[model samples]
Target: MIGSRVKYRHLHTFVEVARLKSVVKAADSLNISQPAVTKTIRELEELLGVALFERDGRGIRITRPGDVFLRHAAASLTALRQGVDSVSQELLDNVPPVRIGALPTVSTRIMPRAMTLFLEERTASRIKIVTGENAVLLEQLRVGELDLVVGRLAAPEKMAGFSFEHLYSEQVLFTVRAGHPLLGGGSVFAGLAAYPVLMPTRGSIIRPVVEQFLIANGVAALPTQVETVSDAFGRAFVRQSDAIWIISSGVVAGDIAAGMLASLPIDTSETKGPVGLTLRTDAPPSLPLSILIQTIRQAAGEVLPV
Candidate 1:
């Protein structure tokens, strides 16, 4: 009722000029002209029947009434600004996170770098990463629980409803802590058969590959001492003891590079296979997922061939 003629233009111009202490700056910030800012403030004072500012040498001074009005006016604008931001943030939060399943290898090696790039590519978007055996991840993909899967291709029968896009080729490798009993002076096969061994969890894509490699090398019976897809457990267990860890190269590439682990000299070319992206054949990737897929590819490129 008191400000029936007052407008957003009047309040905004006055508040900005007062805050900046310069009409020239307020006009520049608002992308208007100096005279326009002065004119608008004058209009606001006329409508309110009060002098909002007094000329103070080259600058300006706020009147007591202007000070009171400014406190309320600035607060109102701040509330409006926050309301706009909250609405935008709510919309972003409402968007379902892009759910993904990653094989242990990809989760450890590829995802860390890919996540950094993905965040850069789409700062407002979000994602969820699930890591486990190949069979488990594929099952999650078949359901609606996952939008994508990254790592080696699944078994032929398991490929019925999923499509795979080849990313790179990697192979199983034998590794142990930097200083282990098996590091010198023994036949590799004998050491593998004799020492406690860690292997890929059963039903993982790499599990079969590793089994075949062992069989070819005269390690006919798989080690039952430990079978897991957990990088943390494998690294910890192997480091504190003399257990040999047979895992995909990507999973321990960093460890080997850092000298925390060592790869044995063995031939696993027969176990080499394609690693790739898997998705439901029936479901097209959402735009955000597609961008993330690209980011993963960029990250994957950094993985050195084993």
Candidate 2:
């Protein structure tokens, strides 16, 4: 039997506090006083008859029960927001835009073509794409901030509440400016360490693979290294210097085709990873989301190799 005392405010407050692990931070985020936030949490705990958090001098930690409840609370909030959006769209006779989260590789290479083809076929459709690291995007999808995330499959632990559909695989590449001094070098092992190396940041799905590749090739570290996942910065940096960039091939496919950049002779097929769509398991696809997925499938078929 459920109690009538629980309210949305309680769930919302609980989620904020759980996310930040601090009542003060949660209160600031909610734009409410600390006492109000604390009161709401207490009320929620009383209604449920379970303690959600364990407080300490440093901060609070979610109890085991709280961890489980947090999932349900977050899901409930997501469902409520989805319902509100659906009602608003129906009342306005407008389709709510599909919100997509993407990683840099997909956003730069695949999405432009996909978006163009989708809009051309469905003239009234609207899409909003946001890009970030794999973990951030997955969390946004879990909380219903995004309809789906299109990117490389994350590790199993990072994919708890989502389902992934594989679209294609992409290989990482070692690339440099056109006519870079190391271009025709017989063995890149010696020359690679001599130039600045640009590679993905630690959290990116491709980072470990790149590190492993370097280790296998007996290169302990680059003389100079810069870590990033920005396609724009990578392109400009490589074009003007002898720096070698370790990145997914799709990120610079256009530049390679245009003769502005060149990939080294190294074969990175071993570092290939799956690029795919991730959706919340609890949320079934809405009509707009389905349409976008279908369009993306078509676009991938045309642009990506099987």
Candidate 3:
């Protein structure tokens, strides 16, 4: 029978090597000898009974098993760091920050108002918001890296082990710079292929929605296009060039109102979905986190027709 053998050193070394993609570089980054790093990885692989990394020509690539373990391993490290900080005198003396995961579409519209209100009420509290694709945010939430996530609800399979609170319904919209050539179109969808198209990134929450809308409109493919999830990039790119940006309504609501952009006359009700907050079912939020959630709800009420 194997005795207790796994340790923090093993996981730490393995993650660094996987991240840096080189044993030597990981050793340098971890301030250890290459031999020690290699030995640690070997030990971890033995304990797990699976090869985590395999040589890919000169470099190394993580095996399917290693890729699977990487997510949990990194999450464990993040949890450990937060756990240590939670009890530290320095952290205990001060309020812990509310770590949040935000979607790009929500960040531009709802986050600023919610965060402003949250900070105003909890003057001593700090906030750290990490924004990314829906899958990434949901994974982070499930693994305890984030206190809560605010955005559109993801697909059910990816939404395992979390509770979503529906706040409002938001639609997807097509927009371009005011008075663009696509404006006087017979059918904007027909004209879309001629202009440069900006689409939601492949992994983002709205990517499938945008793609489905386009496909249904006979825009199955385009010659010139960019796929991104950056609201700032989309805003700038669409305004500067004859680019048609398909994005959530809230992201460009302010711009459309100010005449910096105009929404194409298209009925896209099918792309509408519920925007809301998501929290881990097993993990209860801290007091500051709860307060922040409340403030966010209040802000949403004011800004949206909730």
Candidate 4:
């Protein structure tokens, strides 16, 4: 009977070559000799009893069998890594906690619930949560300080090395205090003009949608009295004054439930924003981060409106 003889390093080398589709390039990337890369590939193919590549005069291509083999090999590697990471992560005496950046709105509402669930599931795992605007969050993501960012991304045209996954759409609500004059009902825009507006600072994804809708309908601009990124401030301002605040329904769901704020009878039918998760492209995420994101998607699916 043949004994178990698979080597972990060989599997890793095979994955790198398969991913790059060129032995020389893979070797250079791994800082090894090309022949060493070729030798490992051959040894791996022999162990599996399958031809993994087809070489022609032009170049080499992964064979149909090779493509199938790669799928299994990648899965195996991913499983092995996840297992190893779970163990080694605990022993990482000096490695900082997995740092995650989240938008303030998300951090305030969904993330607290998600984090509580994550901690319950992973007692040994450590995480650092940072809150910021998208511009700051994306920069931290690119510099490797952050593993994942939860928010609506800014400027897809300029974001070449990042990928975004839509978690859910947040409904935009224009809200005010319960007894505010506009409380019962009125023309949405004209009513807005009577009250000072609490607006998200410019360039926020929320701002453009609100501004454009008001302008397109020829709704006169309300007095822009407060501009801030703090949802707490916005909600507090609404409770104390006649200022109208445009915000995500999910963020203020609890407040609305408590009767702290009242949703205006305005047509928000045209306003929807994607609350998304952003990750670095062409890279595999850390296992803890990956599981956390998966949990977020599941949680978002359950809570976010369709």
Better of 2 and 4 by TM-score: 2
lDDT of 3: 0.88
lDDT of 2 at 275: 94
Badly placed stretches (over 4 Å) of model 3 are 1-89, 92-95
lDDT (Cα atoms) of all candidates against the true structure: 0.86, 0.88, 0.88, 0.79
In candidate 1, stretches whose alpha carbon ends up further than 4 angstroms from where it belongs are 1-7, 20-22, 42-68, 179-182, 222-224
Q: What is candidate 3's lDDT per residue for 1-306, written digit by digit as tens?
A: 332677899889989999999999999999999999999999999999999999999999999999999998899899999988777757646766778998876787788988888878745667899888878888888887888999999899888788999999999888899989878869887888888888887888888888888888898888887888888889998889889998889889999999999999999999999999999988888878888888889888999886
Q: Where does candidate 1 have its weakest 10-residue lDDT segment?
A: 216-225
lDDT by residue (tens digit), candidate 1, 1-306: 666787878888988888988888999999999999889988888888899999899998899999999998898888988999999999999999999889888888889989999998755778999988888888888988999999788789989988989888888888998877777757888777677889777777787777777777788884556987788999999889888888888889889999999988787778888999999989999998999999898888876442
In Å, residue 82's CA in model 4 sits off its true spot by 28
Backbone N/Cα/C clashes per model: 0, 0, 0, 0
> In terms of TM-score, which candidate is stronger, 1 or 4?
1
Ranking by TM-score: 1, 3, 2, 4
Each candidate: RMSD to true structure?
A: 3.1, 20.4, 20.2, 17.3
Q: Looking at model 1, how many pairs of residues clash?
A: 0
Q: Give the TM-score of candidate 4.
A: 0.66
